[model samples]
Target: MSNESVRVVLVNTTHPGNIGAVARAMKNMGQSELVLVAPRSFPDEQAVWRSVGAADILENATVVETLAEAVADCHFIVGTSARGRRIPWPTLDPRACARQVLERRNSGQQVALVFGREDRGLTNEELQICNLHLHIPSHEDYTSLNLAMAVQVVCYELRMLALEGSLSSDAQSEWDAPFATAENVERYLEHLEQTLIEIGFLDPVAPRQLMTRLRRLYGRMNLDEMELNILRGILTETQKSLHKSSTAK
Candidate 1:
């Protein structure tokens, strides 16, 4: 798996020093791409100082205003979450998460490993943007982990897998098309919601977990570009038919 295909993303980080340390951790694991989403502080001496010899990583990091922008081009996204939510996502331990990341990378997919803020971690809405959720499996007495520490743990697993060279590369190899990017998936979901509303199948006024559940279902499918296009075409046809029926009436 090429390290260039795997992106380490930090979202809404409060400390520049932590960002520096994360870059260091990523560098130690042979990773190069770093993305920062709405960091509270950056380009600070504290961050450069924390990076030590890894200052080059900081120099090339991409800073964005939102998580969507940080991973829009990425096809596979993994978000780090420490706590359980009302609707449990497909949670993976650090090792499993690392394996999945490498597998996707080997299969020619752009993958993003997303880390959240220092204090609160990723919001539920942010976590929902991810295709999979990763948990470090810390001890019950002290489950909370330092931001850099959490990153280091996952990065270490990735490094070990890369060094061993045991990961299978057959995943999605026979597929005719590439997987849909995160941005395209978001766009398709928006299109789906609009069609559902047009058909009176979903009530926006009392929208509960319908969209969330649909997102989960689609995320699990790992839909390819062709599959997504086919689904979108069906939605468009359905919309056109509804418009025609309304005009006739």
Candidate 2:
């Protein structure tokens, strides 16, 4: 199954117990990969105690210094938050989120379902790294969720989608190009930002939200090799035009 390809990423997780509980939830859902980004406390006694039989996940968990490092190789990234952002992200409720993950996983692409910190959730900059945002609908008056509880709910939806035999796909895409990895797309965004600045379309000194919003938009496009090449060619031509203008002056 593609379960092994689904990575659960915890960013800036503070509570050791919550991390352990997340491990248990992931194990229950058959997801083996767990990435912890700058967690406050891990390998704690409380976490081990809470994990019980799922301590293997905690022991095998890959800890990184940054969220980018955590999901660098993933082809699809989904982040979770309790509230909305000022510039809304492409979102899916738990059900649609599961389907998207499963589809990408089935297509042999690694996917990361990211959970944010306990108190404030993912920062706007971190959320920009994601392709999709997900929120679990809860009571309107009191919507706060414990970190582990949110993990459990998302994991449960994933497990249910698998059990229900809904993960299959009949549509065959003729394109052979693989979906661009998150790292590659990130680099592409950097190139795009630089080109835009060179073309005088984007003021480098006051970029504002231009790059972030663009990243959010193209992050979901799942650009293939041909598409990426075409985009880079356009950027190359734009740069050539800038060089020509400078030579003329």
Candidate 3:
């Protein structure tokens, strides 16, 4: 696993000590990159004091104003949450989430794992930006974990995945390279929605929630460039067929 492919991001962290501890945890796992989004007390003397031998991580950390800025380059994002949200989204355990991250990294994609504030966790808006939600299994009665502890657990799982080499026999082959870029996927999605609209699959007046669900489904697949092209071609052909059918009628 390329060390630079995966990054750990802490958003709105309030405690300087926690930040230092997180850096230490990441270093212990042989991971170096750390990003801070709108930290409350960054570069603080307390933080530097606590970082100890991992001070290099603190010095090299990218401090950004917004969460989006911190993760804009990342192709895959996984957010950690201890509680279920009001919205419906598929949730994965830490190990499963780590596997997903590894797969994306091995495919030469940058991935970001986001951890929210220490006090309240991620807000609804922040959670929406993430493609996957990860939760560490714990005792049912008291599951709220310290921010540093949460980071440690997640970093540990990711490190283990990296060390283990291949988690399954179905490891990605060279042929499974990304066929399309992020921009290509977005354009294809737009074209798909337009085609669906033209075919009356989506109501013009009041479109159903199909597109959002489809987006989520496709996001989970992390479609490569070739797979995306195939899907786009199918959509284009379907549109042509619809046009012919309309002309015939």
* Most lDDT-accurate candidate: 1
RMSD, every candidate, angstroms: 22.8, 22.7, 20.4
Order the candidate numbers by lDDT, best to worst: 1, 2, 3
lDDT score at residue 74, model 1, on the 0-100 scale: 93
TM-score of each: 0.65, 0.64, 0.64
Model 3, CA-based lDDT: 0.85
Which runs in model 1 stand beyond 4 Å of their true positions?
Answer: 1-5, 166-249
Model 1 Cα displacement at 115 (Å)? Answer: 0.4
Model 2 C-alpha lDDT per residue in residues 1-249, reported as the tens digit of each score: 565358889998888988888888778877778899988887688888888789999999998999999988999999997665899788888988998888887888989989998888999899999999999998999888888888888888888888776544533355678767788788889999989887788998898999889999998897987788888889899899889999999
- Put down candidate 1 lDDT per residue, 1-249, tens digits, no spaces: 465348889998898899889888888878888999988888778899998889999999999999999999999999999866889999999899888888888878999999988888999999999999999999989987999899888989988888765545665777899999988999999999999999999999988999999999988888899999999999999999999999999
Clashes per candidate, residues 3 or more apart or on different chains: 0, 0, 5
lDDT of 3 by residue, 67-93 (tens): 899899889888988766888766898
Among all windows of 10 consecutive residues in model 1, the one with the lowest summed lDDT is 163-172
